[model samples]
Target chain A: MDIRRLRYFVAVAEARSVGKAAERLRMAQPPLSVQIRKLESEIGAPLFRRGTRGMDLTEAGQALLARASEALALAADGIEAARAVAAGSRGRLSVGYMFVLANAMLPRLIPELRRSIPGVDLDFAELSASTREARLLDRSVTVALCMPAIHHPEIQVARIGAQPFMLAMPIRSPFARLGSVPMARLQGRPLIALPPPERDPSSSAVAALLRRHQIVMPIASRVETVHSAMSLVLAGEGFGILPACARLGAPRGIVFRPLRDATDSIDIAVCWRRDSHSPLIRTFLKCAEKAVAPL
Target chain B: MDIRRLRYFVAVAEARSVGKAAERLRMAQPPLSVQIRKLESEIGAPLFRRGTRGMDLTEAGQALLARASEALALAADGIEAARAVAAGSRGRLSVGYMFVLANAMLPRLIPELRRSIPGVDLDFAELSASTREARLLDRSVTVALCMPAIHHPEIQVARIGAQPFMLAMPIRSPFARLGSVPMARLQGRPLIALPPPERDPSSSAVAALLRRHQIVMPIASRVETVHSAMSLVLAGEGFGILPACARLGAPRGIVFRPLRDATDSIDIAVCWRRDSHSPLIRTFLKCAEKAVAPL
Candidate 1:
């Protein structure tokens, strides 16, 4: 009903137990219960049902939950928007980056954003391209630096640059000595790739490329993060097809080589909500465009 | 630095203007500026560089911005955690859901969760998958009904049921007379799909199916909501693929056909943070598992 009630409702809904919600809200249980009851009464519906085992939502409670969340997010966004406007340059922008590219790209972009947006505070999170597209549509972040052109209707993507995919081989490998293995020869070879189970874009892209080449699948090793995968490649675990850009901080004893066919290239894109109203966001997108324009 | 100072820093960082941050924080400009300076001194770095255009974060400020967001999120979660424990069966649970499914699925799931858990309040939000995933990782929400099998290392996923994908044909279409079309014939026909540009499982599933049929990429009439798209279909626009379980509440003019390949399906999943220690979350996940077991 009210923002405070909505906040309380969100807390309780998330906790899924009144006693816990009360504690999280920093209030006593009885008062929290009373507030919830009042909310249910105001809405003329039962918000929750409880029993010996636990607590859960009623039909009405579920309906209220959706509106409550949107209201809260909008409220939060509103406050941030207002503050950004007032500050003339400062605001919090949630930013999503791929772990593989964070080191190469962020070091340059963050500095500029800080310089230009000044009052803008950035909330940073790492995500795969799949996740980045979702975030862009949800307006969770003001800006996203991810693989190029995911094609969501709700988001606008600007090309950052295209980086060719390179095979990361141990410096002493036969392929390395030969400069590059023909795509055909590498067929049926045991290649190391981050498994689909981990949801890395590079992994999926590699899988797609392999599929295109009529390879049923390649031997895969699951690495939790890009750094770990790169480490394994350096340790001679297997060959890794990494994005050329992610190789900026490439560890020792690993070499990058272009594929015979350059079709194995990926583009980096800067994305944001199509309807974003934040000036800071607008400025950052422009800056991002300029930063990577020549590349 | 104190949490209050961090809050101020976040505000200042967001607003980029001391005066605006002060206003939002409900304090005077001078005091707020001093607080930021104190924080900078404590951290042994100049957090922001003042300028006529506005305030900008120095290198240290950028680092702090990322850290500060996590700290604030943790603080917020700590409060919720404490509340959940105290509320027992009568607390709130903040639920995150995708926009379209929230309407159809939540009405049913809420009551079921309430029946199983009991005395629980529900707070809901229309959350994009990326935000929900991030919040779940951050413990901002205890449970979320989302697209199944998102591959986040820190997030746990439980597939509740398959939300079948259906082909929605316009009332005026030749296929509408048949009540269903040969699934293969519909292939390569002009089709409208929710622009998945986000690599969302639902969108990707549709794309994969279309690709399997060698369907020319559907003429995207527009990127519209499921409901709106359905309405357009009913009004004689291009056909669309929708989750069979979704409540379109559409008039009788529209038609639906289950894809011929039974494997064609989108999964409904309940997602929560794997590392969460909250007892309430444990209880909720347990109860939720039972409610959706049959589905």
Candidate 2:
């Protein structure tokens, strides 16, 4: 039977009379009586006995009473669960972040998230240039923290922060003593290059930035991750051009200096699918903005 | 949310387009779209992206999908469970039977019930005269197998079978040699009477039956149960008057002799509260009829 009929039956069973039940339900007696009769006929069993004194529950009525209450309670629980998720207070959020962003940003972001959406589960996926766009598109990750943030028709980006390009070189290098270096000074220098991003595999972000500045740096070494790039720079094999935040986790004996000639910088961005309507993704994006962006 | 909203959400989520989902649901598109919009607004989250191509589930929408299906399924299961109990096909049945009737009736009844309603859990309560009416009215027992069946305003009974009163005396007793004995011969003999039924305490059934025949028999002893009455008869305290079924479990030394010249008999009946509308009770009563009645 439907929930409304069960409600009426429970009322009649408890009150032991349709008149009293109708009063409790705030309805007239005749309609309540009709509903009870309809329920009994639908169930193919009598749910109550009409007596001179009042009414009495049949065995069938007793059976339905306990279960109907449980069903109603369960339905209520379902609605509350959906509401909690939709309100962004509860759910799972898989965040894909570049290693450099993870080092500087997570410490600030995690605490903010705990305070705001304590019911959400956090999943961290370390992103590589090749996987950044794929993870967001495939939904393996709901949001991403990317440098030189992804540009795609199906993707949306919020620039939480930005940092000027910096050079990673051995402490003993001649340029380390000079402090900042101009883009023209690095035109003929051997450079450590990272694998190209998923969206543009023809050239790395550093190479593209140099091309925009009319500087042509020769590729000395190519590596999979920023750590490997730093290792090469530490070994004096080549200098690495990196986001300014990368200095936070730089290897010992390596120094990062800003490139002075160009104002070129990379975005510390939160990216997600353009169509993603997940409340948790939006909630996380706000926290990310707070954690890393300028006031 | 209510089950209907969840149903619509699931349809749209699966179809990935409101127009397509509306077609599948056999409703017009605009109304379906309106319902989906109402659900999203009520949930306070965007459940889908209204892209030109089609609809896509938001993270919150994904979270709700699995749970919504579960809630709908649970509601359906609840209705099915209630219908099963009301249909008399599933539930528990508590049966209270007089000791003598239990000896004969249960064997036939239990098997029939198992065949007819396999889901019912059977509970048996042995009834004594003092607790008979109280058990039925208080609902401690749903149905009863009684001899000299109960008579009360709120109790309804159907006579399944009956047997004339028979004499239970020791094998070595002088009257044991006779095929039957006249009620007049029973006059003045010591009798073992059971405690009176709950409704009447002034006289036991055998005492009342004797009074109906205008014959007076001396009360040599009184006992609580049929077993005790048989034990007293075996001890030569008094002869016992019992229904024929008692012979099934009678002690080896006792012989049952028909009482000639007396049409007085005890009914083997199934009794329930007049107010009881339990389908299971009615179902059990029918099985009782088949088990103990002749045609």
Candidate 3:
């Protein structure tokens, strides 16, 4: 049944007069009468009986009235539900994140996105730069927060901001005494903590930075989560490379030193499918733009 | 995009040879070639490069391959999920139960249904008989394991089995001495329990049974749950009416005796919507029949 017909029927039923129902519906009486008659014909049963007194109900009319009430309720609920989704108020959004942006932007971006779109459900999944590039092309995730590497024709990237890499070390170590850690100081270090060995650009970027200073030390340990690596560093275990955002979780026994030299600072970008048209994607993109505006 | 075409394209991509993919797909190579060409034409991009030794991916071919794989995966998952629901292997089934059935068939039927349909998700709700009747009419629950009542056109009921109503009293009560409780013995004895003022057929049936014997007494109390009513009986606080199936949880202090010259019996039925055509409805009806067969 057309939802409009049910709404008109409900209004007529409630008003008890066709003229009053049309007035309440803000439409012409003839159109309202025609819609009700159409509804009756489609259902093969009259919804209301007219008499000199007013509209009353036949046995069939009573049954239709009950059914019409339920059908109209469901229709109203369906329209509202559709509107909520179209307005980006309700739905699921799977986000792919790179380690650098995950630490730098996620804490603030996610909360802001939630406030901007109250009912947009969030599902977080970690994606290395390699997998994220592949995922964006395939539309596996609606949005990807990562750095732009080799650009693919099927993907679109929105540059958010950039941050320089920082060296994380034990507070009591001699490296902490330097105002800025020298590139040569990291040379031949017995060990360096690394992010998960998955093809994350952050890990590769750190390796490249080390390589630029002619430092080639075998990775001692690889950790999946940043918190675990931070905990180990705080225990005076080993030195590691991290972005400025990772510095937010600076443990009491750990110190961060700026890198003195680099070919270029890292840039973070939100990557999406070239054809993604979801309203939720636009809402999230807006929040991302606001998040990186000051940075 | 057609899911079948996507599957065929994936096979070609993985094999890198249309002839080999056709052989693996158990189809003629000519049709597979035509189908792939049609797909390329539809997408306005050539998805394969002609080579003498073996087929290789052009840039467009690689992009289409990724998108095709994703589409095929989602289509396959959606079909499997829908089929699982149809077969009662997954998805939720909300059930409503009467108070007496909750005490009797619940303990056995619940566990049996779970064992028989391991993946049949259940959302069992405690409901009064009147509420169960209304909800069944509204399609609020997929099924109602309840007693047969006044037939309504919108509701469908299938009789599972019947159990005789028995009288229960404390072991110390005078009526417990008799092997079977006689109608004359209950006269003017202050029958401590009866149905609440609501329109429950079980209570009405019991009341009709009493009126047939021309016996009436002040109701000492009215309780909703069978467990609570049984508690009152076991405490020597009142004489109560209970279904024979409720003997499963007979407390140590209580003794039950069948009523002689009484036509009171409880008939259990699986009630549902008369016009429910949902596949889940069909599968659950089958499971319920199998579960209640032992009774």
Please give the range of 10 consecutive residues that has the lowest summed lDDT in model 1 chain A. A78-87
> Using lDDT as the measure, what is the rank order of every candidate, best first?
2, 3, 1
Query: Considering every candidate listed, which one attains the maximal TM-score?
Result: 2
lDDT for each residue of candidate 1 in B178-293, tens digit (9 for 90 to 100): 64555677755666656563545444777777777666645757554666778777777688787875445555788777666646778777777775443556666665566555
| lDDT to native, each model | 0.68, 0.82, 0.69
How close to the true structure is residue B48 of candidate 2, measured as C-alpha lDDT?
Answer: 83
Q: In candidate 3 chain A, where is summed lDDT lowest over 10 consecutive residues?
A: A74-83
Mind giving the per-residue lDDT tens digits that candidate 1 earns over A81-116? 434443445547788877777777777778877788
Clashing pairs in 3: none
What digit string (tens of lDDT, one per residue) describes model 2 on residues A173-257? Answer: 9999886887888978998988776556555567678888888778898898888899999998998998888888888999998
Candidate 2, residue B88: the lDDT equals 72
Whose lDDT is greatest here?
Answer: 2
TM-score per candidate: 0.34, 0.81, 0.46
| TM-score of chain A, every prediction, order shown | 0.60, 0.84, 0.72
